[model samples]
Target: MTTIEIDHTSRWFGNVVAVNDVSMTVGPGVTGLLGPNGAGKSTLINMMAGFLAPSTGKVTLDGKQIWRNEAVYRAIGIVPEREGMYDFLTGREFVVANAELHGLDAAAAGRALATVEMEYAQDRKIATYSKGMRQRVKMASALVHDPSVLLLDEPFNGMDPRQRMQLMELLRRMGAEGRTVLFSSHILEEVEQLASHIEVVVAGRHAASGDFRRIRRLMTDRPHRYTVRSSDDRALAAALIADPSTAGIEVDTTEGALLIQAVDFGRFTALLPQVARAHGIRLLTVSPSDESLESVFSYLVAA
Candidate 1:
């Protein structure tokens, strides 16, 4: 099986460091490059795609160096997040152009378009296509070479529900066939449903790497912050503060809510309603304040 190895790699743009010293192995199977926006995911993907060179260490395909290597293109295919395309060309023409670059013909392009379910709209100009359609056509262009390794950066960004599922199934099948597939995504649910393994980056740092469930557990176990509104905010805060599960609670006078920090997630969740009932305080609104993927990633980085 094909494997991509990143060894202590780092990339810098003048004074700004994009990717920090990070090392990870992407073997045959679907691996998710997970992180919020501006977490160096695109920088890492560009390095892996041989479009950018690492400033410090190495990025290799199997045993060969990927940077400035022309031969690696035969084994690698990339679906970039950027929307640059031949606007005047039809979908079929765009894919065929990519195919010809690999010394292939229209037959290969036709098969790729079919694989991405874009044959019906192949005659339409790319400028006339929707964002989702353009994304699929770019995927077709990438697949036209039938490479053993596929690298997709935010592949589901513009896809609708059905298009998302179709691409997920295609990646899964490719991985099942022992082709190395790596796609970057910020959405937790997308990664949870599509990737067999996940590599998480935060603030240009490699924060975690493992199965989705394991990563999910880490996120779940972290200290969670929540906002709670009750009929008696002060009374609810006083009761919740007495519990060991709650790390801290601050009554926000402006919002008329209690900002709670729970160190023990399970215990705090179980104790909240019980405490509210015992104190005769009616809970009105309970919501997690830091539920964004960005916050989750930040928590992992802190851990």
Candidate 2:
């Protein structure tokens, strides 16, 4: 099985650091590169795909250097996030071109197109294809050489539910065949549903790695922030502050709510209702204020 190793890799463009000191090993399996947009997921993927060189450190495939090495292309297949395609070319023609680059023929391209289920519309111009269809064609091009390592950046960006399902199943089969498959995605549910292991990136830093369930537990255990609006805001705030679970509470006059920081999730959840009932405070609105993926990633990075 093929394996890609990123050893303390860092990539910077001028003054901006795109990928910080990040190190991770991608082996033969489905691995999800989970991160929010602009968190350097694409930069790291480009390095793995041998499209970009790291400013520091190295990216390797099976201990062999990947950058500027043409030989690695035989084992590496990439479906980039960019939309740079030959619009006039038909799906088959495009995949055939990719095959020719690897000393392959039309037969290989046909097989690739068939694998992606794009043979039905193989004769159509790429300009007429939907985003999902384009993604599948790009995937076909990547598979034309029958690569051992596949790197996809946001492969499900424009795919519908059915298209997503089909692609997921295809990737699962490839991983089962012992292919090293790594796909970047910002959606948590998408990653959870597809990958056996996940590597998380937050602001160009490697935050967490390993089983999705354990990483999810770390995310859940992080301090939670909430906005609570009640009939008796002052009384509720006073009651909540007396408990060790409530770290702090700030009265937001503009929003007519109390912004709360809860340290112990379980304790705070159980205490809230009891405190509210005791104070005769009817809870009008109780909403988690920092439930975004970015917030969760930031917490993980800090931890």
C-alpha RMSD for every candidate: 2.2, 3.0
Candidate 2 — which pairs collide?
A: none
Least well predicted 10-residue stretch by lDDT in candidate 1: 158-167
Over 1-303, each residue of candidate 1 has an lDDT whose tens digit, in order, gives 899999999999999989999999999999999999999999999999999999999999998999989999999999999998989999999999999999999999999999989999999999999988998899899999999999999999978998899889999998898899999999988999989899999888999999999998899999999999999999998888888999999989998999999998999999999999998999999999898988888889888
Displacement of the residue 105 alpha carbon in candidate 1, Å: 1.8
lDDT of 2 by residue, 1-303 (tens): 899999999999999999999999999999999999999999999999888999999999999999999999999999989988898999989999999999999999999999999999999999999999999999999999999999999999989999999999999999999999999999999999999999999899998999999987788778899999999899999999999999999999998999999988889999999999987889999999999988888888888
How well does model 1 score by local distance difference test? 0.93
* Per-model TM values vs. the true structure: 0.91, 0.87
Evaluate all candidate structures by whole-model CA lDDT and list the values in order.
Answer: 0.93, 0.95
